[model samples]
Each structure stands twice: as structure tokens, then as C-alpha cells.
Target chain A: MSSHSLATRTEKTEPAPARTRRTRNRGWKPRLAPLSILRLLILFGFGIFCLVPLIWLLLTPTKTDAAILGDFPLSFGTFDRLAAAWQHLTAYSGGILFKWMLNSVYYSAGSLVITIVTGLLAGYAMATMRFPGRKTILTLTLLSMVMPATVTVLPLFLEINAVGLTNTAASVILPASFFPFGVYLAFVYFSTSVPKELLEAARLDGCSEFRAFISVVLPIAKPLIGLLAFFSFVANWNNYFLPYVMLSDQDAYNLPVGLGALMAGSPALHPERGGSFLPITRPEVALAGLIVVIPIALLFLIFQRYLVRGILSGSVKS
Target chain B: MTTSRRAAARSSATAWAFTAPYALLLLAFGVAPAVYAIYESFTSAKNPGSLGLDSYAMVLHDFRFWPAIGNVALFMVIWIPVMVCGTILLALLLHERVGRLSSTMRLIFFLPGAVTGSAAVLLWYFMLDPQVSPFAPALHAMGLHNSIDVFTSSHLAPIFALVAFITGVGQWIVVMFGALQGIPEELIESAKLDGAGPFGTALLIKLPLIRKYVIYMMILAFAAALQIFVEPSLFYSITQSGSAWWSLNQLGFAFAFGQGDFAQAATVSVILLVLSAAAALFLVFRTDFFKTEVES
Candidate 1:
């Protein structure tokens, strides 16, 4: 099937030499196609639109606040100033920034484990097995996706506080783990791609149901796993409101929430507040933004192939 | 018969085992809190002795309520269409230019999504500032000279929409592009064989084929847009000009934290919940969102 699709793709992308000659004889001056040019121009325009802010962000951490205001927008400042900016950022409240970074990883990794395990299992079950209340569970998952996460925050806070777990990491991890979207994605992939005969063949060989799932289903779910892990990790890592509402203690704050507090406390972001003794400034804030963004960006770059392949194969198989 | 019945029971047990952990978590976190919120929304915080719709009435009467709703409505009016249409157009364009170029551009487009939540707000705060923005010259050319001109209350919706679009439209573009890639090459080739140009093929063939995914994207985008909190709240904190309750979610937060009224907060949540869920339910049933057997 994949080869068939590949052949079709190649044919569509690259027309035959005979056909090209025939078109040339027909006076079809398709060279320098206007539409392709327009497409490239639009794509590049959108590309610049997306990258300018990121480029600005990357350069911001290197400059002093004065340079940010006085110098050219895209100009580079010295590494000396970059080092000074990092120092200022790290100096904020005696290196709380590092702690927030650690907390972000801790929370995201913990929740990712649960999201994958549960989402994969449930999705597999819903796809393959005929069980009572299966439709109900699926419906509930969709309904859960419909409601915005913000609607649940205060209530989640109330429930977590009622159980005396508000400040702990579990308060954030547990709620973040309720990823209905992952389960739905898994369900779609399994139902569409995974052949029932494979599992049945394994079961006939005296493998238990769970064993067949582990051996037969999981081996082909690499793309699904990649899709789930990257998304769950990014969602958990970048999530600010839940962690902010749940964790009141500054030490327990994740990078995003920590950044918010840093902004609020900074004299630089809030010029209305005028000057203060705190060293947190635009460069420091920009560095903090980079710190929050770099890990996820690195993850995306590293996993870009898997992520795209996952998306492609997901629908291609269907 | 007995043996087959036993086998059926055993398989059911195994399936339950596989799904049990997730179901339990969903019940504990998703359903339980939602139910609790529903109960709280009906019960008054001020007069717990009486359980009724007084909180809803109080919320309805609050002067900030309508304006907050209006603000989010305006944001939605801008955000949802731009996101859905922009995603589709960009995805179509990316699909047009296949191979290494498209892949690299797709990655470039998706890069902004990584800078999300409060970090996005901070980045945009600078990005919109006329003096220091990379678009400083453009801002000056447009006759805007300072932060005040950029951050005005009148400009809040568009600014937030632009920020959301920049940070958002990428992932959806990627998703929509994937859906487009799913289109059987034969179908597109056949359409081309019939002399359909790129525009006609995209508008007529590709668009219709990916209709389900588009609807799915639109529904999710609408729900997310309705919950616009972090951007507006962060902006309000930094600017200190827009009302603290600039959006519905913030209004809910203010009701809960600012006034110590969980009932009013839950009232706001319930309103949003119903709005989004109703919209979702309508769309889901109108389309094949739940049909496991999708026709490829």
C-alpha cells in the first residue's frame, strides 16, 4: 500500500518526459509557473511572519535593555551582555528560575507517563475490544474535550484542596494527565491501521490478551507513541494556568508560572511601576522566555521527523 | 457454549483492565470536579443555607459581565475564522509545494507554538511595543509611536487575536496539512487528468475530502478561543489598564478569587461549559466525529 502511494506521489510530483515533450510541442509554456511562484512567495511570507518574533526572541537575551531600546531591532549585542543577562536572570530571588525549570520537567515527565500508559491502554481497548459501556466512555472522552480546561480549573483546585494536595506536584500532574485527545488519537490510529488478524494470530499462539497487546499492538504504535509523548509533554510543560492556580508556593512553580510571577515582579516589564532595586529587566525576561521555550523547541526539532511521519502515516493508512 | 461464554467474560475482564486506569482517572479528575462545579454553581456561597440560582442572577446583574462576554465574543469573531481559514489556506499551500521545502516550512510554521502560555504574552508584549518591536519601522510608518498607542483598549481584541494566531495557527496548519496529505494521490491526479487547475482541485476536491478534519479543527479552535485567559490576564497585569475581567475566564477567576464566591465562578464556568459543549454536540452530530468507521 505504501509503495503504491509512493509511486502515485512520484508520478504526480514529476510528470513523465514524454508528457513534458508533448506539452512543450503544444506550446504550453508552463516554465516559471506563476502559481508555483505565488505559492513560494506566500509560504515565504508566512515563514517570515512566523520566524521574525522567534529571531527577535533569540537576539533579545544577548542584548542589554539599553541596546534593546537603542540599537537596531535585529542587531547582535556582545556575549558579555549575554552573560550579564543570564546572570541577572539567574540572580532573581537567588536562582529560583532553575528550580522552576526543574519543577516543570518534574511535573511534565510525571504526567506524561500516566497520559501515555492510560491513553494507550484505553485507546487500544476501545479500538479492538467489544466491551460494555465502550461507546459511553468514548462519548465522555469527546465531551471532555469539548469543555475548555479553564472551566475545570477552579473546580479542580477546589477538589485538590479538599484532598489536601494543592501545593504538591500531584495536584498538577494528575489533572494534566486527563488527556482525552491522546486517547481519541490512539483510538483512531488503532481502529484504522492495526489489523485485528494480527492480534487474533497472537492470541491463537497462547498469548494472553495483554501479552498480545504488548507484542502485536505496541510494536506498530511507534508513530502513535511519538505523537502522544511529544504532545503530552509539550502541553504539560507549557501549561501555566493549572500550575499557577494549583501551586501557590513560589518554589513549586513551573517555568511558565514562574515567568509570569517574574514579569509581574519585574520593574522592566511594568514601566508604569517605575524603577526598583530588582535586577530583572527586559533582557532577563527574554532569557527566561528562551529558557521556557528552548527545551520544547529542541524536542520538536529532534522529533520533527517522527512527528511529521506520525501525522502523515496516521491518515495515509486510513 | 459454556466455554465460549467463559471466554467472552474473560476478554471483557481484560478489556476493562486495560481501560480501568484511565476511566478511574477521568472519573476522579474530569467528571468529579465537573459534577462538583455543577453542584456549586447551583448552590450559593453567600447563603449556603439556600440552594438556588441566586449566584447566576448575581452574575447576570454584574456590570462587568456583559462587557467581558462582549470582549470574548469579539475575540472569537476574529480568532475562529482566521484560524480555520488561515490553517486551511496555509495547509493547502504547503501541500502544493511538497518535498523538502514544504517539510522545512512546516517546521518553521510550527516553531511558534512552542512559545505558548505566559511566555507568548511576554513575547507579544514586546513584539507589539512600537519603540522596541522588530516591526518598529512598520509601527512608525503606520503612525503609532509608543506602547500606549499599541496597547489601547480598542486594540486589545485584534492584538490578542494576532498573538493567538501567531502562536496557534502553526499546529493547525500542520494538522490540516497532514489531513491533506491523507488525500489519495490517485484522486488528486484523476482530478488533474480532468483538467482541473490547482485552485479548482483544492477548492472542489481537496476541500471537500478534508471537510471532517476541518470541522474537527474548527470545533477545537472554538473551544480553545472561548477560554482565552492567559493572554488577556497577563496583558492586564502588565498594562494595568484593561479591566481585570477582560475575558469570561478571568471574570470567573475574579468571581472565585477576588470575591470569594465559588458559586459565581462556577456559574461563569457552567455558562462557558454549556456554550462550548452545545456547540460541540451540535457539530459532532452534524458530522461524523464519533463514527469509528471513517470512510477513507
Candidate 2:
């Protein structure tokens, strides 16, 4: 029997009329069913929900505070207004906004380095090696992945304070490097994606396991590395509570804490707080939010290709 | 025999060497602070050296404690399942049509996550206001005429749930879509050959295949939601409608920074840690999350 008839045979258990309907609708251009239309509408609604606020945000910096309150929410103002907003934002506290951006870079980069090195090596060992405490380590990593950063912030502050390291950049970077999620991601990737036979073949070719990992494994793990780096950088860069409690000096603050402090001082966001002489109005605040958002969005776009392939090996066979 | 034994010993040594740095970090940052938190929870300022349960009693007795728990419970109830279901459904839709349009939609969904932490709360503060929000028409239609109407205590749960879902569901879509892609094509082809339609294939084959991933997402999302701090804290700052102690972490912050009661703070932290640990450990151990070997 032909495959088409066999397929129909498999569908014989269904009611007779439904089978004829299915066969009749089996052509390439199936009619647009109600379900397909509903799916399209739902997806279009999702698109609008996600994009509208971002579009609003992108336009806010271009407009004046008065325009932001008065004009159409999606309308754009002028480049002159955007430049003015940037000028007012940077002029606050002697360009502290730029300093906060730099501080964010330093802390995020430092932690990213540590997270990648330790997470990659440990994940490789757990996936490929026969170690005594591997299961315990893996379980602990899973638990730690879900543990709230707030739960540890106070205790970590106390620990760092005891070591006389509070208010230092190390206070943030050191703790942030303990990224159990990145390690877990790497573990999942290595165990599922990398074939054991490849490593074994390398071993038989007179390659030390460590040498093989450095040579053969590292080359193929580029996408995983990118995925790990992107996640670690985002988490460290956007982290607020840890740095908020750890760093007391204003000069040491990262973007989130700095912007928060700036907002607290502004009368626009906090109406109860009286206005200051600083020119940080609604436009300037929106500009600051954009400053904090642009880096991660750029990174996401650049590394997204690697992201899809990074987890693509979820069920790959050896 | 001697060579193989020596090789085994050498390989074991290599494994330990590679693993030591991360182990030490976990010990220092993860285990050490938790141990210190336990110790601090028992030691109070009234009796500096003596260990007691007074701090725990103090935290448990606070009137704000239970309300905070209830608020978080309500938020989680509204947030987690909606976020999970929305993520899976959106991912399946995106998987249905693989083209430039779907890729662009994916990018749009993930865009909100870029403005995370306090910035996200800040953005949503503006976005929910009927006066300036792009959704002003919708807000007015919903009978929220101003910020006052927008931020009532009764409305905070859904508002925060929407915010969290918007910012979070995108990343999981990427993840779930990847999980869908990981299903071997032959299995799907065979199911198709059995005359299964798209909906049946999704429900019967794809959903079951990604069950473990969904469970994993739920556990982690639950643990994260249990300690909802940034949304409530930032919102409280702007609105001042609710008590400052609106969530567990906020309460803990009040004890630690606001009142300098480290003991009480540590007690709260310990309670949160235990709750999260119990939930996580129970789920992780119950599932195949730690299974090193994949059958495929």
C-alpha cells in the first residue's frame, strides 16, 4: 500500500467524515483555520505589549518634560531637546553618571572573567570526570541557582565587612562571581552536547585529558562560552541590591543604584521629595534609564545567534 | 593493570584540580554566608555572646511578617503559572513559523529584560500611569484615571505580576523554543506519519518531551518569586501607599539597614533561605534535574 493510504489507515480509528475532511484539506495551501487566526492575533497582541513601552522609552529622551506630559505618548521631539537632556544629566554631580557607567563595566567585567573560568572548568569536570563529590556539587549548584540574592546580601556584607573589604569594588565582584546558574548552564551544555567518544579518541591519541579539554573541547564550546558570558555580564551589570548594600561611597555606585539615588533626589519620580537645583527632570531621568538599558540590549542582539545554538544541544545524541 | 590504575589516579587528580577553584568559591560565597547567617540569627544585640531564639521570635512576631508573606503568595499565585504557560505557548507559536518575522518577534519579546532591576520598576511606574503611559487609553478604559487609581494596594499584585511576566517570559521563550528544537526530527516525523495534526503533535509529543524543562522553570521561578523585593520596595518608595515592609526582603532590609538589627535581619534571611532551600531541594531531588546522563 502507498504511504498516503497507510496514513489514512492509521486515521481509520477516527470518525468517517472527519477522515474525508482531513484528506480533502491535506493540500499544501490549507485554508486559514480559526485557530491559525487566533494564534496570529495572540502573537500580534504580544508584539504590541512588548514593543509599545520600549517605543515610548526611546521617544522620551527626545522630548522635553512638558512635551512628555503633554504631547502624544509616541511622538518624537527634537535632537536639540535630546542633547539638552544629555547635557543636564551629565552635569549632575560633576558627570557622576559616566563614572557610574565605568564602575558598572569594571565590576561586570571582573565577575564575568571569574564566572567564565570557574564555571567552564568545573562544568567540564562534572560532565566528563569521575569525581567523588560531583553529585553533591551539582545538587548544591542547583540549590544555589534558585537562592535569592537578597537572602545573601546582608550576610555577604557582614562577611566582607569583617574582612575589611566593604565599599570596595571587590566586595561586589567577589560575591557576584559565585554564579551557580552559569555553572549549571555549562554543565547541562557539556553533558548533553559534547560527545564522549570524541574525548576518548583524543585520549587514545596520547592526549592528556586536560590538554584535550583545552584543545578539542574549547574550540567547539565557543557558543557556550558566549552564552555564559552574556548571562553573567547581564546579571552582574544589572545587579542592584548587592552593590546597593555593599558600596556606601557615592563614587563607587553602579548605574542602577546611582540612577535610583538620582531618582530619589528628583521631584519628577518622587513627587513627595522637594525639587533640587539640579536639572534632572522627566526627560533626563528617561535618558538615564536608556543609558542603563542600551548595553544589555546591544549585547543580546549581538550574541543571540550563539544563544540559540548554545542550548540547541538539549537532547543531542552522541 | 598498573598503567591503567596510575592513569585513573592521575585523571582523578586532574578532576579535583579543575574543580577546586569553583568549590572554594561556593564555600566562601555560598556556604560561608549561610553559616554566618545561621550564627547571626541566634546572636542578638541584647545578649551579645549568648545564643537564643529571641531574634526569630521577634521576626515571627512582627505584624508586617505575615502580611508580607501573603502579598508574595498572592503575587506568586498570579505570576508563575501565567508566566510559564505564556512562555510555552509563545514559544510554540514562534516555532510554528520559523522566519524573519518570528525572529523579530523574539527580539521584541526579549527587549524588556534589558531594562531590569530598579530600572524595570522605574519604567513600569511610568508605563502604568494613566497620564503619561502609552497605555493611557487602556488604563482609562479600565477605570484607572490617575496614579492614585493606578497604584492602590489591591491593584499592586496584578500590576507587579504583569511587570514581572513582561520582563521574564521572553528569556524562557527562547529557552523553551530551544527545547522544542532539541526534539529529534525523526520522532516528530513518525508522529506526523501517524496522522497527528499540529495541535495533537504539540500536546501529545512536544509538551511531554519538554516536561522536565517546564518543571525546572517552575521550581526556579517559584523560589525567585518567593523573595520578591525590588518591585515592592521600589513601588513603595514612589507610592508610599503600603507599608515599607511589603515583602520579605524589604522586611529583612528594614531590620538590617533601617534599624541595625542584624540578628532579626539574619533571622528573616534564614527563614527565607530555609523555605527556598526546602522547595528547591524537594523539587530537584524529585526530578531528573541532576541526572548526568541523557538517554537520547
Candidate 3:
């Protein structure tokens, strides 16, 4: 909407005689005409604050423990040390680090499919259909959406365990799949973007409810689907607390839980577990940390537009 | 018309069909667990003598409760202002399209949000360690010999708050950056025509335009700060001083997971829900977010 308006304004202003004269009259530009050196420095300073640690995270894995302590924080270590860290990380607990990464993939992918499907169905139903309990459904969705997610962890653990689902992937994937936030996002998105007449036309043409959603609505709703999918996937992937509470089997732990264990002073990462002489070291844990981080960074790099829109959508409502 | 009315009823049934899966989930996970948590908070340990407010009484009187509340209270005071002012300043700077370099700076600033929480905490854990930290040389210059000297009882609060600032600020920057982008360019251009400098435009014009988001950020930041856990939790694992800087969620998490005291844990969760519910209610009434559903 703003882009179209902006294009029109540029069209109108570029041909005006005053536009050129105004630019020509402004004389003597500094290094950055719009900003002073101090302002540029402040922004750069904040940029460095955000970046320095991540640079260290990347570089630390290349070095030995002593070198991590002694060398320049941003300097590279030998490829030999990097290979050794990977070897040690893989050797620990028969390469459970890879197992955790696989488990994370399973949990996040499963939950992503469920979240998108349920959110779209519910959101579309709420937006287009007249039903008896629709208001109550919408109200509860809003209320629960605003409630802090971690608030129910203890009771959810009890609920999951009472039914004998704990320690299974079901424990993590099922609960994480119910994305109230995504449901709300879809509901709001459909209400604002999709015209009522479009769907009504499909109904009047004798299309079945499911057929209409598949044939008519889904084609026009690609962006919304992408947005909801990205949001829920990121949330499920970054999930640490719930899985930490639910899954106790060391072998079943997802990436966050397993990486946390690898870092923990606990017995799981202990050398005694495998009778291996090589204990997990700083570089190994750092490498494992980088492994846990890469997929998410790639996901963000790929689907950044929808992800940014999904996040900023909250700002508008608030 | 009578036949068309029947068609409407049939379609409404179809709508219910579409909503069934999510509705079932909402009941099973959201409603049931919340009700159970409330019930459990008032009872004794399962299969105990009788039901009473014993858990609530115990949690309220626990030595950890008041101090944890005070600690998070102190955190809220520090975190909220930094979140508000810092996000505004950083976002305003980014909104100014200062050549092609601004885009690179934006990505650099935003990359931290992509970094995992565990990694960020691990980095800070080492960053604050005096002996092996990257800041060690500067720390030596200052004559602070160790983590203990730096994270002493009096200094622990700011240290925790600072870690939060470093990690938490990026997401808000991204949000406020989006908010700033919504302001019309004409205003900035007109301000330039009126001889307003960048600072004046940001302070006077742009700031007033995004006042709604400023308040929104304050409320949301307060909610986030109240639930502070990960940084302190990780720190405590190594330092054994988790109790000294017990944020509310950390304290409750310890009681729940560490000690296996579910009733006290549920009480803390319930208190958080009530507080969050009040904030949610305020938002619903203040903005017409709910009204849009009815109108549509």
C-alpha cells in the first residue's frame, strides 16, 4: 500500500522544477551529509556490540581451549584443531550430538505442518463462516495467545505424563503444534486481506467447503501460509524449556536439550558414559553450539521477508 | 429465501468442521492445563491429607519468594527504560537511509536475533569471566581481577540486566525499525525543507509519531523482564549463586524442576498469568483489536 503511494509521489515530485533547485541549493556536503561522525560511530558501536560475541562463537571452535583463552578473540585457529573438536564432539556418547540434531529436525518439521494446517483452517473458518461458537473461539484464542507460553509447563508435563506420552516425540511435537499465535495471525490476515465476496462466489458456484478452500482460497493465500509457517517453525526450533521439562531420556533430547547437556556439568556429557579417554572440551561444545545455530540462521536468510512481516504484524495490533 | 437459509446453516456446520482440530487442541492443552494448575496450587501434594491453600501459603512465605520478586522488580526498572530509549534511537538511526551502508548495518544489528539463546549466554558467560575473557586486558587495566570482583552481590543485578540488554534489544530494534518505516516520508522531507536537522526530526517529529509503539514496547518489555530466566539459570549452574539473583521464573523453575515442588511452582505460574491477563485486558480495551473481528 505504501509502496504504491510512494511511487505516485515520486512521479509527481521528480518533474517539479522546485525539486532540482532545492537539491542544488544545498551546498558543501560532509562525509555523510545526513549524519555526523558521532552519530555514525554510535550506530557502529551498537553494531559491534551485537556482532562481537557471534564472531567469537564462530572463531572459538577453530581453536584449542588454551588458545581460546589466550589468542585474539577474532583470530582463526588451524584446521587441524577444528577437525579435532569435531572428532571429539562426534565421539562423545557415540555421536549423540547428531542424534539430537535429527530429533530437532523431526520435532520442528512435524509441528510446522500441523501449525500451518490448523491455523489456516481455524483462521479461515473464523473469518468467513457464521457459526454458533465462533465468538467464543475467537475470544479464547486472543486470551490464550496473550498468556505466557511457559506458564503452563508444569501442568502440561503432568498432563502429558498422566497419559503416558512423556519421553516420546509426541511429548514435544504435539503440544508445540498448537500455535494460538499463528491462529490469531491467520485470522487477522484473512479478515484484512481476503475479500468476502471472493469466497462467497465460490460457495454460490456450488463448491464444497473443503474444495473451496483447496481450489480458491489456498491459491490466493500463499503469503499468509508462508508467514504462519515461518513463525511456528522458528518457535518450535528454538524451543528449549518445554522439551527440557518433558523429555528426560538423554538419548531422546532435542538439539537444545542435548547441546545444553553437552555443556552442562552433568554426567550425560561425562567421559565415564562411553569409557572414552577424550572428554568433551570447550571447542567441542562451541562447535556443537554452531551446529545447533546454522539451520536457523539459514532459515532466516531464506524466508526473511515473510518472517519480518510476521513479526511486525504484532506491532500494528498493539 | 427459506431454502437459502438452510444452505447458510449447512455452511456454518462446515465451518465448525474446519475449526474442530484447533478447538480440540485449545481445550486439551490450553484450558485444561490452566485449570489444573489453578486447582493444583490450592491443594497439597497429590494424594496428601486434604485440599487447602497450604501450597499458596508455603510459596508466599518461602524465603525465596519475596527476594525473587524484589530482584525482578529491580530488573524491570532498569530493563524497561533501556528497551524503550535504545530501540527508539537505534531504529531512528536505521530509518535514515544513510547510503547503501545502512542496510549492512541493519543486518549486522539484526543478526544477534538469529543467534540461539544458549550460544548468546555461553558467549556472555565467557565474556564476563575475568581470567580468560576477551575483555581481560581492559579488565586488568581496571584492576578487577576476577568474575567474583565483577559480579559481586551489589553488581550482579546490573550484570544480569546488561546481558538481557545485549540479547533482548535486537528483536525490539527490528520491531521498532518496522514501526519507524511506517511514518510518512513526506514528514521527513518537509522537516528538511523547514531547516530541521536529523536529530530534530527524530526527536520532535518521528518520536511523537511512534508514541503508541513506545508505550507498547514498555508494556511488552515489562512482561518479558518479569519472566527473566535463561541468563541467570545458566550463570547459576556454574557460579552456584543463582539464589542471590533469583528472577521470578528462575525461582519458580527451580522449585518446579529442581526441587519437584509442583504446587508452589503452579502458584508462581498463576501469579504470572493474572498479571499477564491484566495487561492483555488493558490492550484489548485500549486498542480495538477485538472490535475488528466483530466488524468484519
Candidate 4:
């Protein structure tokens, strides 16, 4: 993909001289028409359409319950209400929100580290080493990649329960670290992006397979590794049902599960909870939801280029 | 420099080193639980339960099982086309237009996808709720006053399913855009030079090239949709009625986990597994989905 862009760059650079020559020979000026006008219009319209909900989410925190329901959807209600909502959400249930955020960070960071390391090692082996049953391993990894995490969540929960680790951080993090998709992404990246002759030359120069992988292949695989880490982190952070079912203790809940619990505890939503805003409310649920999305949105803004490349590179083949 | 002795020694030593961790983890988390679930599916017992196929029988015999299947079938029928068509259209739009604004537009369209499952669901829940949404007036104009009322037995599954589709379009759009960007510009230019209009170029040149990607998107969408959870689970909180589990899926999950019937939950999971695996296998073997040509 980079090579394709490089070719385009060279073409653009070379075309500058040719354009001047053509104009001189023809003794005429060329029209400088702007391309992509229609595309830009459509994309801009779609971008606003896509952002409406998020904009609404951001504006929502500022409103009291009445203002949230009665006022304009996009307008801010009061700055005080935003702080009030945050305070209420944090103080609700003995400040369980902090615990949930910590749990999310632990789960996402722990799994991300393991996934990147394992994916790199496993992907490097598959790409470079001609091991027995390597094909079988690749096929199994692909199959696992396509299997929905939800389908396996039940069995996995039970397994974790059997091991007496259901409510612990490990239950979520351990399963999340074994992302088959990341492994396959790394494998394809290493195979296609990294040249094989480089590794062979390094091996012939007395580097062991492991050393060759570390020194020669690792540098090339760095961009892909970063991409995989980000993907893994986002996936683990956003995970819901696994932790929802596995962790019963409120203190162990991650943001998604915590938000769900807030919804469940909302009095207007749940009649059993006696429909009051003393404990939790719709605005608090909204606030929690906003908090859950903020980190991911921040990460995306920071690494937008790599995220796009990672996803395209990972799935374009299939 | 004796190769045979070195090869034998290396093979023996490295065999465990290479396969041990993956094999152990796979068995402990993947294979063992799957086998145990299947085994438990056939049996009926308490927490420290007995072994047999009664659980499967009970699950199949339950009135909810078939209905859940029907609900998922209905969801797939509605979901797959919307996702595929919307993604393709959005991707085409992004690829045709190249500018700074277009780049920013692509980023915006891609933002919702970056937000994970729970956040998207919650966002949509608020968006769809009649009380808080900007769309309330429009819905009211259309004579639908109560948004939550739309989640009746008849419309509940479909509405939530549509919500799921809308929230998920971001990722699909990104995927389709990537495929669109890969089409050689020369092909498009030549088609234009041949007097083919934009619609004709899209139909003849672009759509055909990205047909594999469309199928890929469909299979993936189907697999993901098969395991619909958060929306319905959230809906349960609003609807409080026992019949909230009106959808076969909600009923299955409610029976298995909510009602302490692990065997039945395992059965439902197994059924989901089969459907997803079938879709996956169809993509892998029946199509050239993953086959890559060697770049010359």
C-alpha cells in the first residue's frame, strides 16, 4: 500500500515538468478544474449525519433532566448540571464509577500488551519459519477470527467460573488477549510486508531465527504492531457482554457493564427500583456512556492514520 | 555440520516450545469449554449436575427456541442488505471525492465505529428514545408519539435491529471505502474516457470489482448480527414485563442464565456457533474470499 502511494508521489513530481512542456508546445493554458466536488458534498453531509448522535451526547451532559427532555436536542442547558451529573455519577453507589474506569484500563492495557507480544511472536513464526503444522495453525487461527466473541462468551464464562476467576480482572483480560484476528493481521502483515530474503540473509550471517526476527523483522513490523495494539486495546475496552455476565461484583465492572448497571438501576427505566433520580437517572446513564466513548475517541483522533491503515491492511485480503 | 542429528534434536526440543502455550490455552479456554458445553447440552442436572441429552431436549422442546431462531432470521433478513448497500454507497462516495474536507468527512464517518459496542448501543438508545431525541418532533409529525411504545412485541425486534444496523454502518463504510480506494484509477478514467457516465462507471467498473468485498461484508455482518445482545438486553430494562423476552433470543438467554439453566444457555450458544460457523465456512471455502495473488 505504501509502495502504491510512493508511485503516485513520483508520478506527481515527474508530471510537473511534463505539464510545463505541454503548455509551451501547445501555446495554450490548461484549465484548473477542482475535482471531487460532488464527493466532498456527499461526504460532508454524511459526516454531519454520523456526528449528530455524538454531538447530542456531548450537549446532553450540560442539561438537567427536564432540560434534557424538554429543551432543544443540540443546545446546552446549564454548565452547573454537567458538573452535577458527573458528581452524581461518581458518588452514586459509593463511587463505583472510579473502580469501573480502573477496571477498564486494567483490562484493556493488560490484554493489549499480551495480544501484541503473542501476536508478534506467533505471526513472526508463521511468516518466517517453515514449521510442521504451520498451515494447520494458520487455518485454525482464521476460523477463530471469524467466530463471534458473543457465541463463545457463554462457554468462556463457564470456564472462568469453573476456575474460580469469574469476578476477577483476569476473566476479561485473559480471553481478550487471545484475539485471533490480531494474530492473523500480524501474520498477513509479516508475510506480505516484510521481505523473506532479508530474514534468510540475517540467518546466514549467523543470527538465530529468534535473533533474525528481533533485529531484522521487528523493525519492519513496528507499524503493524502499533496498529494491532490499538485495535486490541479498543476491542478490550469496548467489550461488554463478557464482563457483564462474568463479573457480578459492581466494583469489578468495566465502563460498559457499569453503564448497563446504571441503566438497570435507573428508576424511570426500572419500576422495581421505584422510578427516582436519587440513585441513578437517564442523564447519568448518558454521562456514563459519554465517559465510556471519550478515551476511544481520543485515541482515534491521535492515531487516525494508523487505525485506518491497520483495518484496511487486516481485512482487505478477505 | 551434520544436518540430520541437529534437525532431530531441534525438532524434539522445539516441538513443545512452539506448540505448548497455544495448545494449552486453546484447550483450556477454547476446546475444553466447547466440548463441555456440548456434553452439558445433552444432560440435565443442578449446579453439580448429572450428564445426559435432556437439556438439549428441554431447550428444543421449549417454545422459545424456535422463535429465537425466527427472530434472528428476521434480523438477518433486515440487517444484511442495509449494511451492505449503505456501506457500498458511502464507500463509493468517499472514494470519488478527494479533498481536505473529504478526508475529514471520512474521519467523522469512521468515528462511531471507533466507539465500541456498549457506547454505540447507549448512544442509539438515547437517539431513539422519544423523550430525549431531536427526532421526537419528526416522529410525532409522523403520528408516532411514544418512541418506547414502538418497542412493542410486533415492532420491538425490528426497531432495535435497525438501530443496531445504523450504529454499525461506520465500520462497514470504512471497510467498503478501503476496497473502493484499491480499485485502479486508470480503470475508472478509461471508463470515463469511453463516454461512460458516473452511474455507468459505478455499475460496470466499480461494483463488479468490489463484489468480493460486498460478500465479505455480508458474511461478517451476518456473523456479528447472529450474536445480538446489548440492544435487547438494554430493552429488557425498559420493558420490565416478563414478556420482554418476547423475542426467541431474549427468551433463550433469559432461560439459560437468568433462570439458571446452563445446559439450555449452552444449547442456544451451540446453535449460534453453528450458524456463525456455517457463514464463515461458506466465505472461506465457497468463495475466493481470502485468496491473494502473488504480486509480480
By TM-score, highest first, what's the ranking? 1, 3, 4, 2
Candidate 1 CA-lDDT value: 0.82
- DockQ ranking from best to worst? 1, 3, 2, 4
- DockQ: the better of candidates 1 and 3: 1
lDDT tens digits, residue span B1-296, model 2: 99999978888899989888899899999999999999999998778889999888888898989999999899999999899899989988876655566668887888888888888887898998888999999999999899998898888888889988999887788778766755666787688789877787889999999887788778778888877777787777778766678888888888988999889988888888898888767665676644443211
Tell me, by DockQ, which candidate is best: 1
TM-score, chain B only, every model?
A: 0.92, 0.89, 0.88, 0.86
| DockQ each | 0.57, 0.45, 0.48, 0.44
Looking at model 3, the pairs that clash are: none
Q: How many backbone clashes does candidate 4 have?
A: 5
**Pairwise TM-score winner, candidates 2 and 3:** 3
Docking class of 3: acceptable
What DockQ does candidate 4 have relative to the true complex? 0.44
lDDT against true structure, model 3: 0.74
Please state the error at residue B48 of candidate 1 in Å: 0.8
| Worst 10 contiguous positions by lDDT, candidate 3 chain A | A2-11
What fraction of the reference interface contacts is present in each model, in order? 0.68, 0.56, 0.46, 0.50
The alpha-carbon deviation from the true structure for residue B249 of candidate 1, after best TM-score superposition, in angstroms, is 0.6
Q: How many pairs of residues in model 2 come into backbone collision?
A: 0
**Lowest-sum lDDT 10-residue window in model 2 chain B:** B287-296
> B201-293 in candidate 1: lDDT tens per residue?
899999998887777777777788888889888888888757789999899889877988888988898888788778767654566555443
Error of 3 at A23 (Å): 5.2
Q: Is the docking of candidate 1 incorrect, acceptable, medium or high quality?
A: medium
